[model samples]
Target: MAEPFWLVRPRHDGGSDYVRFLPSQEAVEVREGSHLPPQMPLLKRRQWLPLKEAEDCRRHLQQEGGFRSSEPLF
Candidate 1:
């Protein structure tokens, strides 16, 4: 399987939004809920986006400091 792009952010309801790309489906998937403890993976709410829109969303989130790079700062 191809690698997927992933992102995550917190919600005002003390939950989280987990975003990932589904390469096979060629779309971005968003999962919203409390990520830990009480999360129901099978029942979590979801949204979908096109690749271009998803990339744009990621860029916007990064600008807001909601996403961080894995690379270490030298």
Candidate 2:
């Protein structure tokens, strides 16, 4: 199984960005904001990056970007 599943960047205003490392795809997938009230569709952004760059993003998100890492969304 893949390790260190996801990284989540949350905002003070109650919105969040969810990120996933897709090694096979050689990119990162970012889910912008939450799906609140079950009405608004979640927006997705993909970045084509190298493995090292993706890992760097994970590090930045966890340490400097104020993101919650690999935590349950419940």
Candidate 3:
């Protein structure tokens, strides 16, 4: 079985408007709860592709031109 990947959409402003990329169903449950870490935000994850597949896909995108050089270091 392949692991699942999610498309995390971070909350722009306040309120509830974000997404996350999780690994497992159990992880989803844990993520859904409001007991996450302090630094971590309260955004939810939207599953997109399998983890294994996503890994390969991400790698391919990076190898090609989908990856960015620098992502604005906070």
Candidate 4:
């Protein structure tokens, strides 16, 4: 098992939609549905959260928001 982490997906309109809990940092990425344009460069924005805060968010999203971590295709 991997440590829990929150995955944030920004909406195309504005703000963000809290995605799900992820297993690792390597799994984080801005995909097609994210706020960024398809041709936009990646990692233009980054937010670092403390371990405790991240875990808390992960649990909240799971219990309250009914979000689940998405498995990478590769």
lDDT of 2 by residue, 1-74 (tens): 13435677665656556766656554554433453333463656666566677777777878887777666343
Q: Write the per-residue lDDT of candidate 3 for residues 7-73, one digit (tens) a residue.
A: 2222334322222234564333112211133345443433456556655654564466334222211
The window of 10 residues in a row where model 4 has the poorest summed lDDT is 28-37
Which pairs clash inside model 3? 3-51, 19-44, 20-44, 20-45
Best by lDDT: 2
Instruction: Give per-residue CA lDDT, model 4, range 1-74, as digits (tens).
Output: 25433445445565344443334554432222233334433334344455566567567766776555654312
> What are the runs in model 2 whose C-alpha is more than 4 Å off?
1-4, 12-15, 25-33, 37-41, 71-74
| Clashes per candidate, residues 3 or more apart or on different chains | 0, 0, 4, 0
Better of 2 and 3 by lDDT: 2
TM-score of each: 0.49, 0.60, 0.31, 0.40
Error of 3 at 32 (Å): 22
Q: lDDT at 6 for candidate 4?
A: 42
Candidate 3 Cα outliers beyond 4 Å, as residue runs: 1-47, 69-74
Residues 1-74 of candidate 1 have per-residue lDDT tens digits of 24555566656766555555444467777543335437553335667877777677768766884754322111
54, model 3: CA deviation in Å? 0.5
Ranking the candidates on lDDT from highest down gives 2, 1, 4, 3
Highest TM-score scorer: 2
CA lDDT, candidate 2, residue 4? 36
How many pairs of residues in model 3 come into backbone collision?
A: 4
Of the two candidates 1 and 4, the one with more favorable TM-score, higher being better, is 1
